[model samples]
Target: MDLNHSINFSSSSSTSSPFDDFIPLDSFMLPDCDPHLSTKEEEDDEAKRSSFTQLQKENIDLFWNQQLFEIQNTPVRKTHHEFPIARVKRIMKSDGKVKLISSETPILFSKACELFIMELTLRSWLHTEESKRRTLQHCDIYRAIRNDQLLDFLVSIANLF
Candidate 1:
């Protein structure tokens, strides 16, 4: 590209980046620009910057939330009105009360406690680093089910079915 085109591209590129675009290098008192002074001007600049950042964050969050909602709401074809064989096997093969929690993206459980322990155990285990203990202690699992956070996510999944 020509020098003029390259410079233009670079300037636009810095602005387009999600993180860096919010604050241009020069705007942060880079040696090239006239120093910004005065409390009112600084406050105004700060306000503008924060507002822009907030808008950007909100827009990005909304975009992902909508995308997730779309995916969550998408319909699936059922093969036989019976649960998929893989899912049935997965649930049946689980070691204990965990089987009560279904893999059906939208989960359903007859007992709240059954759903709670299983979902949290699955999520916590998956997020755990390999070096970390694979299983949570029994007390923690009991507490998690008591708190119901696990049940909530499970219900969200169950509702999908």
Candidate 2:
């Protein structure tokens, strides 16, 4: 089969030339945007950002106030074995040389432990509020742990539990 015979050489009957069908690229191009127009959009974006930040701060403050209210309204009670006195004695004993713990030592340690727990809970709750969350979560505690370099060891130890 001849390759020349396979191809059609017939001319089109249409009157429109190739240049007539062609569209100018500039016509399809985007119009020049005003620099001032973007500045207006930027101002709008800045306003939205500031408003969002203010909203978050307000939420945090509200959460903190609610927590403070709850703390004030709640009655403080002293419960027996609330702080694991025996565990404290064991820990003191585990120091190798000190095999015996005085009876009064456990009682004082228990009170100290209670205070420590309350303080840590308050701090962790504040961290939660800072994140604009009303409810406290474990991640808040983790964040607290991470924020304090002294608690880095506790973070690894607490993960086991």
Candidate 3:
């Protein structure tokens, strides 16, 4: 019934607190203490960034050229209507506001999907050739997106960038 009697404050005694060893704010060195140091650091960073960007651009150009050469040398293959119609129908149904889908919609969607896959594969193959690798990687896709500014915008709008 007595609330004050149930609490005990002075049960243990430890003099040194955990934060006692911390250095004062005034004694800590500021990141930009020297103006010249910051300027030099910034210059170095800019140079590194520009060099990296140039390197990336060169790589992208090389890949693109290789893709062009391959395209010229390779024989054309016949297109097969392999896209799944059921999957396209399911996608069309995902929109709650649209209840009905035209019968031709699925065919168009399938063709679009095929084109999208082909484009992605071509871009990814370019990356593979750039890296001199046999298999494609996620980094290849990321680099491809980065190198293609238009694709970058599309990806950004799609929230994938």
Candidate 4:
């Protein structure tokens, strides 16, 4: 595990990352960005970033639009969930408070978990765009979970990422 092979840090007194790999330290400046200048596009982006609710609403609208397209084009689709019912049942049964669950209950839970994963991935992608990165990072997902109060339940899990 050679440090030079993975990450290369500059020796300059002023912390300026050349973007060899990774976000490198705390610097959030996008590539080729001039700190002193605020262009029209940058100002427009700043305005968009200021309102989280509007962004969330837009995302939800896009999701529903896609869903409607799917519904219209494919009238008959099988009920499918990415989550395995067996795994969901095992998790549901893990809690001592739960004694027994009906057959349909596990299926519903599996579908719910699948929907949650899709929504979380969508939200995380938004964060990735905010960082101006083509690739998704753990921090992006962490920021997504942190920003949404409804996702507070996953805060502990996100911290590990």
Task: Choose the strongest candidate by lDDT.
Answer: 4
After superposition of all CA atoms, the RMSD between model 2 and the true structure is 12.0
Clashes of 3: 0
Candidate 1: residue 124 Cα off by (Å): 34
- Model 4: lDDT equals 0.77
Q: What is candidate 3's CA lDDT for residue 95?
A: 88
Candidate structures ordered by lDDT, highest first: 4, 2, 3, 1
TM-score top scorer: 4
Cα lDDT, all candidates: 0.49, 0.69, 0.68, 0.77
Residue-wise C-alpha lDDT for candidate 3, range 1-161, written one tens digit per residue: 24456544553566544344766666356554666568789889899768766765676577568757865796643343557777779988998987998877787678667656666666766677657899998777777666676587656644454
**Two-way lDDT contest, 2 vs 4, winner:** 4
Clashing pairs in 1: 106-157, 106-158, 106-160, 107-157, 107-158, 108-158
- Give model 1's TM-score versus the native structure: 0.26
Off by over 4 Å in 1: 1-35, 76-161
Candidate 2: tens digits of C-alpha lDDT, residues 1-161: 24355444447866444445566678449677776768789889899767755754565567668757865896644357457777888888889999777787887788667655765676577677667899998887777666656567788866764
Between prediction 3 and prediction 4, which has the larger TM-score?
A: 4
Q: What would the C-alpha RMSD of candidate 3 be, to one decimal place?
A: 14.5
What's the true lDDT of residue 74 in model 4? 64
> How do all the candidates rank in terms of TM-score, highest first?
4, 3, 2, 1
